[model samples]
Target: PPARGPLGGWRKVPRYNALCTLYHESAQQLKHLQLQLAAKEATVRELRGSLARQQQQQQVGVGEAGAEPARSLVESLLEQLGQARERLRDSERLSALRVEALSQEVQKLNQQLEEKNAEIEKMINQPPYEKEREILRLQKSLAEREKAQATSDVLCRSLTDETHQLQRKLASTAEMCQHLAKCLEEKQRKEKGNSDDQIATERSNQVFLQLLCFVHVLLAPEAFDSRDTSSRFRVHTGNQNHMHIQTKVEHLRGNSPGQPGARRTASQSEQTSPPADNGNSGSEGRAQGELRCPHCMRFFSDELSDEFLKHVTECCQ
Candidate 1:
């Protein structure tokens, strides 16, 4: 009945239609796998481009302190990429095995249909299937590349966010430092100003005290007596005779040192002319702390005697 040997195998082949169904399912799975691979490759390419741009920006943006974290992130990304590539390689190996198995089945089918060799040869000669497999392979590779690129892109974005946050923090810190420096400078300036003012005030006080000492030295009764050797001066007798005493003091100043004895004798003669009662009263009045300024023709009561002395010194000068 059925042809023997090689042709007889076709009778068993129909009974094993499930094998063809298995082959079709495998082809369908391979197509899906290839599509998945293509998508992964596209994702990888996009990610790679983004990662490169981000790396350039990162180099410009970060300093040594910031570089530490960015380097860590990049290291982690690289590790993940390495793992992904390993998985992709494993998938590729598995896909190659599956394709090899499908090719063996095709060869077996060709052997079983020896009488249909010409038709099979024509089918094999058609480029469409080979082209489809090539396209699917290319898509799978592209998908793997794309998957890797996407991961890199995500890592880049995260790093960029971190960089921006750090930059903002650094800027704020710098502003605070500037503010503190300004405050310190202002405080120092105020302290310096206060010190300068204090020094100036002390200098003025010292000058004033020295001036007071000089004035005291100038106004001393001893100083006047030492300078006017021609005059043997005594206190005025009374407030009533202030004008007469002032006139005599002026005449004494005008006289030469040679007339000291004659001036003293004249002063004693005038003093004796006063009545005894008047002289006693004048003496009592002199005891009461009264002062007269010969140069200014002014008299001062006891309360104003200190000021009167200062004024007399100035007038004499």
Candidate 2:
């Protein structure tokens, strides 16, 4: 037999040897019985031939006195032959029983041999213990990997939820920032409009003060009297003062031409101008052509002395 492992085939060798020895011993016993039966058959045949010879001799010497002894011998031979036949029958029976038992023993040994062969084949195909242990180790590693995968899946889900929440917060913050920016822009625009209105009002007030000074200088004749030394000095400088007033009027007109204050001042100047004097109508007409309100760009007659002052007051407000 071929060996599958060091001990696998060696362990069965003793039993195989014992079975083979038993079979050989049984064959030898059967052969011995057969030889004994052949010997007994030959002996019985020899005894029958010898008895026939004795009977022939007795027949030939029928009247002799030795016939009695011969008859006694023949009787003894027949008895011996019957005993031999009985012994042969007994031997045959014993041999048949022995052969039957041997056959049954051989059959049982054959069945046992077949069973041993099947066991040997099974052992040959089976894996070794080391391979079985390796398979167990691999299965354990696979289980650990599956556990790690499950944990990773859970972590991924949590991270995904966090990312979604952060995105929503960012979107809300952006919207709030946009709203704040729009409110700040509207406030700045309103502040700028108020500042512009304040600056225009200041300019209008300064123009009104300048117009008042010009009107006072033009209408107040006592300030230009030549009797006093200070009045004579003022009369010498009146032309210069007139030029300065004209420059101021042109400046104010250019600076704020289309203001609502200017429109109100024009209407007031129209209402305040006095009627022309019949005696001095020609001189008054020439003077009116020369005098004008800077705020409304309207000429006035000299008889309307306080009209410019009243128009400036109304227009500046």
Q: Residues 90-161, candidate 1: write the lDDT tens digits.
A: 766876787677678767775656655545555556689786998899999999999999998998888677
Estimate the lDDT of model 2.
0.52
Per-candidate local distance difference test: 0.51, 0.52
Model 1, global lDDT? 0.51
Work out the TM-score per prediction. Answer: 0.24, 0.29
**C-alpha displacement of 227 in model 2, angstroms?**
99
- Which one is best on lDDT? 2
- Candidate 2 residue-wise lDDT, 1-317, digit = tens: 45445344455556656666765675676677667666766765676676576678678974433333355665675676667667766766776676676667667765765666677777667789866898999999999999999999998888677556544544543454345445434544544556545434343333344345434443344432324453311221245434543444333343233355654543343344333235444654454334445334455544453775576545434
Off by over 4 Å in 2: 2-47, 57-95, 127-130, 134-317
Please give the clash total of every predicted structure, in order. Answer: 23, 0
